[model samples]
Target: MSGALLEAKGLCKRYGALVANDNISLTVAPGELHAIIGPNGAGKTTLIGQLTGQIRPDEGRILFRSEDITDRGMPARVQFGLSRSFQISSIFPSFNAECNVALPIQAKAGHSFRFWTPAVVIESLRGPARELLGRVGLGERGATRASVMAHGERRQLEVAMALASQPSLLLLDEPMAGLGAGESARMVAFLKSLKGRFGILLVEHDMNAVFALADRISVLASGRVIVSGTPEEIRSSREVREVYLGEEFDA
Candidate 1:
């Protein structure tokens, strides 16, 4: 609790002949924004899956707030204050934005969806759901159905839903995946505003957003971390330049 908010030590995952994540170790300090950048097939997805309990590591330990949770399932992890947002938007197409977030709020409150009533109709769930929608810059769009919202707005809805559980550590996998320049900039600003409030482990491909929002960065290549350091340090690293950023990184 006093040290790293989330710690992964010697994490390894394998699939027959291929090693997805090899001895991966990283620490995200309390309220720190840590970014993971890598090329395709660099095992970023595998590592994120292991962290969120979607995939189990072949060998390692995962600690959250000083407690080991290597074996916890996804739901258990969410209950323990670890929440994840996927690369693709996961929202209820038929539900309004407020209802979408309220469902997670209900889930986090240990409620069952046995009732046929909509989540937004439940006064108790609607208040906090609306608050979450405002927190993610969707305050005015609460009544917009997911099917009618733009792609970027849908992604914002996903984040609001993730936050409905009040997670201590947020694993964001490519929040900027399919956004246009303006949308991406808005998202980067939103994430920047969240820095120091959440211990964020961001797996992103947008180098501009990554460098702008990350407190520290880790570069993964061939299923292993090649370097982890501050943005300036990473930018100057010859290894990162050659393998990922390339010679025209600054240009």
Candidate 2:
């Protein structure tokens, strides 16, 4: 079996008296899709922040590819092939979708951003940018401005930007947020197509999408992982149902 692509041990983060993450630990195996689900204010965002290097854990070790990266900053982590998508859409609103993605491609290629030069004019960047857009189902929308695109398309652009880094592990924070029912289904399908291509650590509130896409699920409650199991096991757990899923959950 493939080894872990990312691992967190004894992760703890605190904000004054509030414990955002309490000694949480988990692993993402190579090419596996691991989803983290919890109710509102369950510390899911904090956990994702720690993984993406946006917030440091007060105590813990984060390992990627068997190397210690606990102290690495965001840029360093990206350079190490770890990328993230935020809870909200993060894209250059004024730029066309292709250019927005091209910027990351240029960065990943080690070229400094050339603000004076139009990104599309750079053949090396635009070609791959269009390809990435296609991967995220925004192929025909490449020339569309991000601000003019629908919310769902903007989210798709964010995913394409994350992929430009060519990451081994992708930390996705609430990719389904703000998506309508149809948009959420399309996003789920897109994410499913990406499975086995890269290790995904998904943080989402959409249980349907979570159950449909995850290979394994980790339920977090009050800053701790209450349980980690397959979809079936999670659905059957009394504690999980009471604390997070509730009796109303069909399965």
Cα displacement (angstroms), candidate 1, residue 119, comes to 8.4
Q: What tens-digit string does per-residue lDDT give for candidate 2 at 1-251?
A: 22689999999999999998999999999899999988888899899889889999999999998889999999999999999975344687889999899877878877565544654447768889999999999999999999899999889999999999999899998999999999999999999999999999999888889999999999999999999999999999988878854424664
Output the lDDT of residue 76, model 2.
92
Q: Which stretches of candidate 2 lie over 4 Å from their true place?
A: 87-89, 111-121, 245-248
| Cα error, candidate 2, residue 56 (Å) | 0.9
Clashing residue pairs, backbone N/CA/C < 3 A, model 1: none
lDDT of each candidate versus the true structure: 0.89, 0.89
Q: lDDT tens digits, residues 1-251, model 1?
A: 54999999999999999999999999999899999988889999899899999898999999998899998899999999999985344688998998899888988887555554664347878889989999889999989999999989888888999999899899998889889999999999999888899999999888889989999999999899999999999988988988865424551
Question: In angstroms, what RMSD does candidate 2 have relative to the true structure?
Answer: 2.5
Estimate candidate 1's RMSD in Å: 2.5
